[model samples]
Target chain A: MDCWIAMCVPGGASLAALAEVEHRVLGLGEALGGAPWVVTHQVRAAEGGHYAGSLQTQRGEQAVVQFAELADASGGGWGLVDGTGLVRGGGEETHMAHALASAIAHRDRTEGRVVRFPGQADLPEQLSLEELVERTVVEDVVRVGVAEDASPLLRTNGYVRLELADGRVRLPVIPWDDGEVCPFEQRDQHPCCDGH
Target chain B: MSGRHDHPHGHHHHDHGHDDHGGADYSDLTIPDTELRPADVSRRRFLQAAGVVGAGLAIGGFAGPRPATAAPGGGRGRLEGLVWLNGDHHIHTQYSSDGLYTVRTQVEEARRHGVNWLVITDHGSNAHARIGVDKVNPDIVAARSELRDMLVFQGLEWNIPAAEHGTVFVAPNSNELTVLKEFEQQFDGTVNGWGAGTPANEQHAVDAIRWLGQQMLSGRTPSALFLANHPARRGIDSPHEIRQWQEADPRVAIGMEGAPGHQAASIPTPNGPGSGRGFYTGSPSAASFPGYPLESYRTFGGFDWMTAKVGGLWDSLLAEGRPWFITANSDAHSVWADDRIRPPGQDNSAYFNANGRYGDPVSTGTPRYDRGDFWPGYYSRTWVGAADRSYMGVMDALRAGRVWVGHGDLIDGLVVTVRGSGGSNPPGTLGEKVTVGRGEDVHLQVRITPRRTPNAHGDVPRLARVDLISGPVTGPTGDRDAMSAPATGVTKSFEVRGGGEMVINHVFRAVDRSFYLRLRGTDGNVSAPGSIEPRQDPVGNSDPWQDLWFYANPVFVDVV
Candidate 1:
């Protein structure tokens, strides 16, 4: 699947509300069909009165959505604002359901969220909360590059460590240089771990 | 400044009247010509002829008492009217993004644990500069009024532009908040989005310190002080930065954390907040100063490796005859056994920004060692010998280096004096210099009072031994990152017997030029020779109450 999915929550959304939004996004795979998939989302508290994001879903088209109060409308609910900024004439629930279904159907190519090799790959079409936590660890470990000037270093810190399977794995979060990998020199220097 | 002195054979009379180095400049305190040398008289005449008098700071001193006195409780002439107030400067409250408790909660807990003075240092976050500082101000003022006996200061845990966190506090006044807000807005690396260690950021840090000094001088605040916190936690506070900070503004940037916070971090996990000693668990990073020895990355006997390593970075600073001091702090965010936890319904934004839901504070009867820190006055403490309880008095005492730091309630009180080899001469305490004749010997007298009651943790700490360390006071080195101490070592150790108050004396033979001596005592729970790492319990398993130690500032001896 190759597509984009974007969403925006109303301003002053509570933590519970944000979690609800996350739950909805994570369940997109099951909503579309009984399928195994991965998705990545960068979540942070929004400052202004609205939260907006664009996601590339499996629908082959990236869709951007926003959840905010409708301007000048007497009664309000979710509706598809056309590319020309005109809302489609439909009820909130019907419009929201249709928009989500279409975005979910537009799938991007799937890939592993955590890889064993250095280099960034494309983001997965869908990611679960469990998988999100796993990706954090993988990123943390790989982020601690072996050399002083590690080519593919993450601006944010490193990945967590739990299990290591064989072969060279790669994750999509970092931009590792092509055909360049330094041995784990930091492994010998670290007081505890041997980065093997 | 030359030829009137002799050494080696060491038979010379030390006037103890005037000093050329910086130790509370007392030229005006003494009557003119009382102890002026023929050479000084001639030089003054030459300067007067050149019409160069009154060109700079007049070297003026207020009418002050003589610098040295005898031990009061044990002997004669000890420093009088000095009260040892147990306090901490590096503390955090809910105003900090990562901190958890409110100002009232922090002050109440600190007072319950016997803290007479404390500085509330919330981290320098964007919100802190925008509104957090103002939000915490009223609570701080209310706490000060309610806790009338305690001195509460509003300060920020600054993310030093190129280094680690430091405590930058101002004397509480109408303009205090304004000064602090502007300072943070302009200099705080975290708030300004320039915290990453870089050359420009390092210069900004130096400029920030100098600006604090400017504030004090410009009367925006009556007084201000800065102390580097958890200096070696990340090994990013390079020796050059420490020196440059002091050089930038000696009055504003005075000392660093000798023993960092997170003292209870040693407690095993599932019960303890497992950050290891001083929360020192991370491997060296690109920003880390490369000159730090391997041992500098770990803690020894619950103290930071810089102070624990005898002749390490601290000694290097002292060796340079600079007034670099060190203190201990709880850096308390949440105390060990704290029961409140952030509810599942709230995210970090609401928890910190809006002060959302948190579990009700529970009783201490339930043990939760998983918490990483002890409240102010709970475990780590710095006892400052101030003249009064006011902000400036405390700042003056801190600037003068009249203080001692302890961990786990290691001792109730520590009194150390360096005087002429006997009870006949006046005594000089830590951070003061005692003048001695070329051939004369100097003695050190230490009086330690064991704890009368258990600490907040309910542990009764006992002293095992006190070690005295001394080193030559050689001025600044050529290499800024130098960490070697070839001539510094532990001179002697006094073992403690069952005690109420123990007084011991030591005498150093044939005096030389400038040098310093310091003190440290431990409960014998953990011990290591020189700079070796102390034996720590297995990770995720240890008790905060078992180990204890205390360190006092150094007293210098100047040979004339």
Candidate 2:
């Protein structure tokens, strides 16, 4: 059995600090002895002159982790939401499963593919994250470890789609480029002069 | 003073119709007294009123007279009557969170660098709206009174909702502070939590422009102007948004920056910051307009891609017969390689949140080469042709698009005139429109005075080439996001040689429809095809000093 856990940490941090937060979450998963995979890291512009982000993760049911205690350790402003009922395997229920598989493959640096339903051959080899969601059916599930090392695992750019109130939002999962910092999250790109 | 002084060198060739416009005579020069406020009259106007019109006309604060060199066969007295005031509208002070200079320091530096007028546009934020706007006004007022020769305006760098930053300024007056403070509190994106990319937030931007127009209509401020700053840097100022801003209030939201600041950011290694020129190295974000291409994120020859691309966004706006103009300025936050740092023992964040500004910066006695940006007027200059050297005069010129922009002191003077061959109507200069019968012959005359003195880099920049770009007036587009004017291109290129003033002429034999013509020149250090050729500036490591360029406003030839 699998369970989904959604956690949102309040307060704004630099890009590097945000990355460290993600690392700490992954480390917590390893300590719990559960194969945990991050689905998406949704960073958004928040009030009070900074940014706030939410991270959603999937873990094995056997891991009975104290989520409330983890929230306390990070900071006071943390919200935990249960995603178990919303996510399931197969059919339209496989949306979260595909999202989870995509992140797992991207994290492990393995090949991943979306198992398309029947009568969907005309779709191109690669699609934008938005186009993929609009074109694919509910039965399609993303599978990992499906191709050789030369080719990209997922048919689309590395974006994890999260279902929000305003439909599906895609966030880019910037891959580790041999320790080269992501330009968007450069350490030196601090808010200077009116918080640009 | 009314008599014309002959040049020492006998290279004058006044062959082409100098008699029509009175032949370089200073006696007939009339100074318009309608808008001249007592305080607005300065040394420049005194020189003009004294009938000092010749090659020895002292420009700004430079000592002595620049050699009066005329282009052979060029029209005489092209720059008579109007005073060309060089200025920078978008500059930051200590009020900005990331800025360091005081209002006095920036003003003195600008005056020393030959900037006749400037605007202190600190960023608009929650802290700024709360206290910074009111606090910075006294400094600006003091600078204005102390340096009566320099025109200092109080403005704010508006965080336009769902778009890029812009310089929102009004003519200096008693009500200037109140209007700006109210505008920022009511409309700034950061102050109102409207920084997201949504339709509602976009509407907020349009509404803000309209509100400024309302202020002008209600006579709160004598004049106001909003020029988008670094519009293409973030790729968030979509075509529709720009179009909407102009449509909302063409008087207020007149144009955008043709080139952005932070030019020293890409000056290679240990000597500079080694980042992208203009600090334009970021990729597209989720909030960015999807229509913008990858190359639009970088600067070409230290200019924004929107203006650098010949027939791109700027031309697209021009084709619609919109009064959209472009300017260049130093969005100076912290001067590059300047020996200044924030005072010690001040927690910047805590202090800013509490006091609405950082403590005054102190001299470190060591230049910080790792920083970015040049002082105002050190690199970029927006030359506005005003009737007099007044606050309203400069604002009116900017609003009328009677302006030209340059980098690295590429040219000292530029005069563009478009005339109908029939000679039935008066000739139109930059930002003016000439109405002529359909199918009438039209010609463009460009007179460029090359830089006689060395630039800040101590190198006299030579104008190697001048390009005459034109496009037809195609009316409005159904697609609001349209960003291309396919018919616009470099119609003519003139190879400039020698150090003397150069004049290039091009004629449109029997023009059929309405069109507009503009001019741009380069130093020949960097070369590529026109915008139609789809050439883009390379990514990063562009030394702004090595590749200098200047862009002049357009002159429309309307076929009646």
Candidate 3:
């Protein structure tokens, strides 16, 4: 079974630091005999915003044991969560992860939001945001366990599950950044009219 | 001069001593009644001689006597007895955080490049507002006295709240420094922490323009102007923000930069910066207005997309019958391939903060191709047609929209006139309005003087084609974010063959609706089907010299 281990580092990490953290997470997953591990940087807009690093491992039972040991060593802020449970949990943890990511990546688009998957190459330098979105394959998503009376913020949350027309699970995934420079959020940003 | 009083400069008292031909009303120097044709005389020479020419006064082989009927009274009529002056208003000096060169060096360079007037618009910042604004005034005053023929105005590149930068300048006066310092401290986005894209911040931008107008109205300054700079480069200047600024105070926020500075940034590698033209290589951000397309982040034919696209934002504004104008300038922080470098040993940011400006640039002797701008008047120029060559005259001309902008010395001069076909009524020139009887035909006559001399790049530019773009006055749109005027497009395109003065004429027959017509010309180096097909400029490596263009302000024809 596939499962995700989420880690929250209260303060935001730099792009370089996040890349190193992904490398460490991948190494730890490999040491526990979990191959095919994917680590993504999740930008969360809670506690004044920070990046929550999450790792998906195919050897879920072993990876959950490793997450427990790591959480005990690091003294907290780590969790072993099922992808389906997170989407159907209808809890604050699910809402926080989904809404913050949506605010950053899907703020402008009115249609299906762009969620990055593993193995996607870094966007070619100077490629515009429009071109990047055009090249990405947008998947149909079905919201599960979302209350109709949810606030506007919750309605825009990315806590969605991919479901086929017959109500079978298509892909259990969460919105993630592949540790690459998002075209929407450039690494090199200057204040308005700062003598570019 | 009924509507002349409506301008902020109408009650202007010229306190500066640089107006050599003081207080002379040249409006009376009309064309003489008799026919006198001088085939070899140039317009400049004729104006200098103050010689009265007859109905068929010929100058530079393209002059034809225009009817001298009494112009319509509201000062919206054709400007008379004018001299065209070339200038740049978006120049920077060491007062800017990212800038080099001193005020004297910039003024001297501007004079050497044939610019008659310039404004030192150092970037607005915390240090700039606190000290740089006041520190730079003495240099400007000295430059004015030393270079009596050149007009140097003190201004700042305002970090407009929730928008792009703007050139906010005032006519030179006793209150110039005080007004500028206070305005920068109170309203500069960087100084006031209003850079975010929020409703309150957007309103602050509008309020800044109104404050400038208030300063002018209260007699603190004779006149003031605010032109949004590099508006489309970052995609932050939304159409609604532009409309709000213009509507805030039409007298102050008169226009925007048609083509941004840093024209040389796209020069190919091993010789130039090899970056996107105007350094316009970024993507949209959260603060950016969503309606703008990806193409808006780039330059088309070395012009801002808003101005380059025929039926785009600029047309959208003009179609509403608003009198917003366009200008081109060298937002010169440093010159491309210049040998000047900041003095050695001092930490730049710390030094600037401590001393209010960088030490004067030192000669490096080795040219730095990585630099991304051209000196003022080296690559871009804004031509203003003024009744007199005084400070107030230039300000009045700009506010009146009697202006046209050119790049790379594309053309030596341009004269556009629109008249009622076979009627004796006075014609409308650039930025003027002519009331015509409904259904009456109108003739547009354009006389272009091609460059007889080589540009700074050591090549004489050739005029290849001229495009006439016109659109209906659809009135203001219900959606302020509207960015397109679908009805506006190229009505005609003229191909050029020789270097002599090219005269082109087009007639609008049986006109029924109120409309406006503007002109744009190119060297035929790079182009696609304009705003109709909505051509996109390629990403990078666009050589600024290879693509030259000139845009003339429009003439509105009011149908009654």
Instruction: Give the lDDT of residue A176 in candidate 3.
Output: 13
Please, what is the TM-score per model? 0.65, 0.73, 0.74
Which numbered prediction scores highest in lDDT against the true structure?
A: 3
DockQ of each: 0.02, 0.09, 0.07
lDDT of each: 0.61, 0.67, 0.68
The residue ranges of model 3 lying beyond 4 angstroms of the native Cα positions read A1-196, B1-80, B422-425, B529-536
A best-first ranking of the candidates according to their lDDT comes to 3, 2, 1
Poorest 10 consecutive residues by lDDT, candidate 1 chain B: B65-74
lDDT per residue for candidate 3 within B1-560, as digits (tens), equals: 11111213343332322222223212122332122212112222222222223323322222322221111112234545788999999998888888899999999999999999999999999899888998999999999999999999999999898878999999887789999998999999889977666678889998888888667544456577899999997788899999999888777788999999888877867788766678776544445676787567767778899999889999999998888899999999889999988897542789999888999899979999987799889999999998677777777778768899999999989988888764656788887777787888999999999998999999899999999999998788999999999999899999999999999999999999988999999888866433222223433356788889999998888887
**Model 1, A1-196: lDDT tens per residue?**
3343434333222223333444444454344332222332212221212122223334421222222232113122222232233333222453343333322322221221211222223324334323443663342234221232433323222332122223222232311122122212111121210100
- What is the per-residue lDDT of model 2 for residues A1-196, given as tens digits with 9 covering 90 to 100? 3344333344333334444545555555555553324332333332211122223345433222443344455542233334333322222222223334333333332321111122245555455434544565322222111111222222322222322212222222221111111112222332335355
In the range A1-196, model 3's lDDT, one tens digit per residue, is 5655544443332334344445556566667664433434444332222344344555656655665455345432455555455321112454334423322222122211122343234434333223433553323222111122322121111222111223221221211111111222222223334442
Q: How much of the real interface does each model capture, measured as fnat?
A: 0.00, 0.07, 0.04
Chain A TM-score from candidate 1: 0.29
TM-score of chain B of 3: 0.86
Scored by TM-score, the top model is: 3
